[model samples]
Target: MSLRSYFLSSAILMGAAGIIGASGPLQAKAHAAEVSGQPQPLPLPPALPTARDVSYGGTITLNVNATDLQRHILTMQETIPLPPDVSEKGGDFILLYPMWLPGDHSPTGTLDQLAGLKISAGGKQIPWVRDTVTVSAFHVQVPKGTHQLDVSYQLLTPVSPKEGRVVMTDAMVNVQWSAVSLYPAGYFTRQIQFKPQVVFPAGWSYGTALRSDGAQSGHTVTFKTVSFNTLVDSPIFSGKYFKKFDLTQDDKVPVTLNVMADRPEDLAATDDQIKAHRELVHQANLLFGSHHYDHYDFLLALTDKLGGIGLEHHQSSENSGPRGYFTKWDKTFAARDLLAHEFTHSWNGKYRRPADLWAANFNTPQRGSGLWVYEGQTQYWGYVLAARAGLMTAPQVEDALAEVAAVYDGRQGRMWRPLIDTTNDPVIAQRAPQSWRSWSRSEDYYSEGQLIWLDADTLIRKLSDNKKSLNDFADTFFATNNGSFVTSTYQFDDVVKALNAVQPYDWATFLHQRVQDIRDHAPLDGFSRTGARLTFTEKPSDYIESYSTLRHVTDFLFSLGFAVGKKGVISEVLWGSPAWQAGITRDQELVAVNGEVYDADDLKDAITAAKAKSAAPITLLLRDGDSFHTVSITYHGGLRYPHLEGKMDGLGAILSPLSGKISVTDHKE
Candidate 1:
């Protein structure tokens, strides 16, 4: 029978019971039948249900009242109809209440402390197996048909400190027995044991990252996966939603969005976000054959406290963040860009499950040495898509690239390590914290790896007509590898092979040379420079200070053998000495030296070099008010340069004496 037929059949068995005490008086009803004479009629006790019997091809039902205070409960009295071929074999049925809810990252692992787990079958309490991890089980004769397993337990709500200010908008709450129960059964590599029907706070709408399978009076979200094993790991979410965007393609592949928001602004932003995301997904679909699922949904929630987080599954993507995060320019741009990043995972994580990801044991450590490609390559697409979608302009894209470049260039870590190590060693891949020196062995896979991808993208564009770009390779990668599952997982070598299969150049040699060994940086210089340029102009102000003190120092140190200004810029030409010899400079503008900027640090590197090696020459690029000129001077060691000495002390102690001076003020105590 079809799922609808099953649901209809089950709904008939459930009958149309008026939702007791939905918005009315709460009272106790007893279930005691009859009593002796002269006594009042006994009240009927509340109904409770429990699971019993596991025999194949059996049907069972139990009458029970689910607990809900404000709203009526739409109890689905349905059985998990296993495939006909699989026999009723015994195995551990695991159940787990995710420590972290969808889009929430707070430490909620303690929620397993539930109170009074009781199961009743036919007005009689039944003994079931219990586990230490807050799970229960029932051993019974295997039955086929439909089985009504009723489980009732009390959930203690956590009182948050930021309650009034915090809000969870567009939230999709899904509760499932099989999900919570992490049980393994037969040959079925169960992803999640029980997927609870959602129980959200009444009046709050649902926005989930899971598809909604149409059901009677409610929605049923069926998970679609190439492999049953892949499907099992991806969880399902269900709840009421604020806004729903149905992107179902002519009834074949379905797409829907469940949107929630804390404020009206959030809804407005989400609307815009959804519109942009639709186009992006459309673009991604061009590469992959067809979305694996019939319908796709985004469980999007805008929360005041919940920061940005996206956990992608097969059919749905869960995204949550602050309400204003998607409205402000910088924050919104970043948030939307991140959403795209997660969206790309539909291909990388969902379609092409990493070899390490095949049997992803969330309980154990996940080792993905190729995260540089997995996460890093995917990260590269976030900004690319954002720009291509018009959310970010080409200039903004260049600026973002500049930021990444500057970060990579300034980092002390990259100097000592190669990016490929992250792909080679699982320890470095997982980012295990080592000693300060050892910790510097790995750099950000996303930043540098993205640069690599960007560089490759430039090369691809230059090598091939813009007609054949990374998009083509992306399409080819997905088409050739989509849904291959276990036997044909894509690896680093597979990616290179794919690129080389259609490329005009030696891709592996290029990857090894540029990615493995550092070369002239600006691999995307042609694209970036053409895309954006910064115009710097000096602005004069009346509040500028004079360099009289520096001149005075120069004059005083004349006997020490340092010319005040010789060359146009600061230049320390002495080798092995303070200035060139000592590594000091002549006329280099002392913008900032030794962790102190020009304002706080009186002496610059050029001046320090001059003082340290009095007999050396140095260059300085000075910008005092409207004056911008290069100056160089010669130095001969002797009298200690007070500015240099004090500056050195500050650098050593991380405290500049000039800036560290304390003020005397009136104090009470």
Candidate 2:
């Protein structure tokens, strides 16, 4: 049967009870009743990637004064050499700041941060003009016989205490290279060579994939020759409080954890915790079967002060989290896959990149068409790798899996938009403010991709009689011959080719239907095929609890289909939910609940009151934009959270073996 038919059949088996929950008292539910639920490493790659590096033959000096980070500014002076071709190309030269950055996959270059923009050749200041149509490009006419130009500017660092600010504390800084430099506009980015040098605050140490020339003169440091690709790909994480731990002892792949935090105490990780992380490398190596880089760096920033962000690179990733990220192990483990996921990108997004995303120049806007496979597949293996390494418990992974299933199932936007189209969200949304996130689904590919891959894995197991699986597909697709810095681009057909090589099917059509076509239900056939099913629970999921605690919000997302902020404000009105039908929306504050003053407690009391009383419409007085209005919502579902249940049938036989198969008991904490 097709993926659609499979879900309809499975939905009956899974959601067989009814479309909506009954208005009864909240109670305990049994764990997946379908079937008995069973349930890295170092490498150092070379200094330079094997890409075309056109030598302009000069160093760009970037001076940063991070000592007083409260000012949120980084001053810089970039000296660029005018290539001989400048004269031949008519001197109307354009210097482009990084616009379309890789990994970010957006035109994220902060043009507004640029100040004191001045260019000089032969000690004479040259007039520069900003392009009308192109925002990032700067036009400057070169003087006669001038082989070099000096450019000076300043950058305003972002300060976001909770959001993972790019600029952390006064002592630590995450240097995004693209933010500080300007490149020539004519050649391919790989063909552009740079001798990068930076001058920072005194006494601050740094860690980056960029090979420092050991030519540190006081606070200033210079790096060896490398292509612009490597220069930008290598992010610098440096600070006052830093700790280095080698994850691998003596392996072909060298892995190291370079952690920086606001406090020294936060850098502490137990021996067991370190061992589990070390096993992460081993597990990944075992899964992929081939290594890409010679060495890897986990640039972890542990701080409550810094804005938390996770962006993947070939050799390194910016894994920023709370102060208790490592200190509070189990609680923070839900997001443990942040490091693993970004690491997987080294293979998926860096080595075997999408054809359209792997552009020639930094200014080229990346066509985010393959984010499903690029980000989606990486997300799948990230959780697997973490679990295999004992970063999370099997039950924790299951809880996390339930969140994915529930997220897709509740994603009412799927009725309007297909999964594939949202791949362009990196450019369009790219972190846009959540206006109507549930109504306008954002990046469903990651969760949906996991579901799709699970289905594919289930299909493979059934076809090959459990002799093969997605692991086989991963081993074939990711691993390359000999460790090299070379990148391989792939198309849609390449994904299907790898899958068919393991087990032949009409995968292209299946994938097209699942990803391109809009459907009412989520791609839950994977659960059914794996001898499992999705079901509802009265309690909140571990994933939900962890996130809710961190964010400090009352999420009745699965229950009433809405989330209330700390100040009795309705943050979102989920699509097709009770609140949506009642005409309740975002920014509306709840003034009263059933004639009582509205607050988190009062809201809960009202919902609980509904459960015990008649499944009556809960009356709520909302403060709309200008006027206050009363909304009556009919929501019988008291408090429902989704979890995966077992089928225990023929498919369950195959699914039970795969559950937590990647996890090793030796590393169990």
Candidate 3:
């Protein structure tokens, strides 16, 4: 019977049956009770008070004891003064831990690590409740005649990498104020004052942007009063082995490089290393033509124990390097550009912020629509400045760019997701590992955005006959309000305006096409405009070699479409590649290749042999979970890695240092 006729007949029979059954009262009640229960959503509780642009009326005193190295606990005591109005009529008061952290570009506050939270007023403990909607907020009823409240908490710093970032180690400690302090609600963070102090382990020197109030008494040090915003931005990096090097240029604003290491010998920096860092400062000034902070500090930690960081701030940056950063400078070229990347943020991200990214308080959500300019342009200048400062050779930077180009070009996710949308990955993915990273792109804006800026730079040079470049844009956009660290927020229109002022063009349409539109291919016009071509070769570039050595991975990305780490574990598998076509995945063990024990060199040999013998498939034994299987990959492509070939005059010009004299002042703090 036809589906329609069958349903119609069934409905008629059911209706007839219902009529016959409804003759009895019990049957009629049973037929009426056929409806399923549906529940409505309950109303959410009221939101916490919104921050107002007004003063908090009193300075908050925050004391942190960070000497617990064994347990990695930061004991915090905060004294908050109550406003006169709040003291007279006690009502609901709210305190917030930082949620939307600056530079993280997401709500990544370590609220889970907060423990033993207690609040008291007038020497008596007061009850508090956490806000249901915003867990970061604490709601409390203030008692009448209460002038102040004493808050105490302990931050359980992660001891292992699996838990979270290890901020405290036996020899060093990184104290981020946002993790250990609470601010009152209903006032702008900039309008709330804070008097901060920290007690560290004995004989451990510290580096921070916060100016010291006086001489340290034993292990305790107090800093001058600053707004809560600045307090959070200025973090402390203290260690037993510490050294400070001055990279100040022309004796103008002071720029210091503070180094902390795992051992005392790791602080041994050669004269040339120091000169390169000084040149980094000089090149940055030559590019932006201004300085934002009165004094800037580069808090560099050279250790393998502390959690790695490259976070930027207005006056200082938190950075990490290998234990052999200065001791083995030749092998550390892959990480040389970290300082440049963070330093550029002083102008791009801190001084000139995205309009939607600026928040009035720590609890406010920040939109990442402008991170393409905030982080992307910074990435562009990072490599450029690294080359210009002699930290990395021009060829090395070119090789680095070649790798970036290859990765984005091979990214299949671009067919569906645009570069602009990846800006949301910080919140969407929180940087968690993905099963198909190449297919599901994660934060392509950093490198892909770098390519976009390169496109703009080369286009500007071509239009202006090499008379103007992105340097002019930087000078016009970021150099404003020199010596002032006050944030200047900008929107999309401002970026386009600045670029047009540098070189007349339809920047809005250009940016829209590259950023907003999803395309199958990455933007490679920048390399072509510079007379360079991205090509694959059997030999890996020096940069790629260093990368593999540093990361402890073997790359067959272009051939087998996967990278193998130690013990023959597949770290990544490119989507739609031969390995992927064979149903291979990441985290799987390549137990054997072509009936032989799995080895990086052996696999390369197998791929090469397969290239010569087209009919012979590369057999692989893989282990997934508890299951083991064998598969044959019919890929004939030999080992291939990306490299740049042809003239790179335009790129060379972009990386060459501007003619200037660098004067350095050596000092120890």
Backbone clashes under 3 angstroms, per model: 122, 26, 0
Estimate, for each residue in 1-669, the C-alpha lDDT of model 3 and write its tens digit: 332343356567766665566657866555566444444234455567788998999999999999999999999999999999989987677899998999999999999999999999978998787876799988777888899999999999998999999999999999999999999999899999999999999999999999999957889999999999999999999999999999988957889999999999999999999999999999998788777788999999999899999999999989999888888788889899899999999999999999989999998988999898999999999999999999999999999999999999999999899988999999898888898999999999999999999999999999999999999999789988667868999999999999999999999999999999998888999999999999999888999988887778999988889999988889999999999999999999999989998988888888888877545999999999999999999987788999999998988999898886534342211
Q: Which 10 residues in a row give candidate 3 its minimum summed lDDT?
A: 660-669
Q: Which pairs clash in the backbone of model 3? A: none
After TM-score superposition, the amount by which residue 340's alpha carbon in candidate 2 deviates from its true location, in angstroms, is 0.7
Model 1 scores a TM of 0.54
Candidate 1 local accuracy as lDDT? 0.43
Question: Residue 592 in model 3: shift from native, Å?
Answer: 2.1
True lDDT of residue 255, candidate 3: 90
Off-target runs (Cα >4 Å) in candidate 1 are 1-181, 185-196, 209-241, 246-253, 269-275, 286-290, 325-331, 360-365, 416-443, 465-467, 481-488, 512-669
- Model 2 per-residue lDDT tens digits across residues 1-669: 432343356556545343235234321122332245433112221121222345544544454444556776777777777766674453566788888888887887777777888998878998876654576877776755777888888787766543225574776887888887888776677777777777766777778888887898878888887788888899888888888888863444568899998988998899999888887777777677666777889998887666677988888887787777788886787778788898888888998888999887788768978888999888888877777778876667777777888878878898899999888887888787676787688887888887787778778888898788888898888876536577889999999999999899999998999889998888877777766778887777887777676666777777777888767788777888878888778888888988888777677767766775576788889887789889887766677777777753533332232322222211210
* Candidate lDDT values, in order: 0.43, 0.76, 0.90
By descending TM-score, how would the candidates be arranged? 3, 2, 1
Cα distance off (Å), candidate 2, residue 458: 1.7
Candidate number of the best TM-score: 3
What does the lDDT read for residue 88 in candidate 2? 43
* Candidates arranged by lDDT, highest first: 3, 2, 1
Could you report the Cα RMSD, in angstroms, for every candidate shown? 22.1, 18.0, 9.6
RMSD of model 3 against the true structure:
9.6
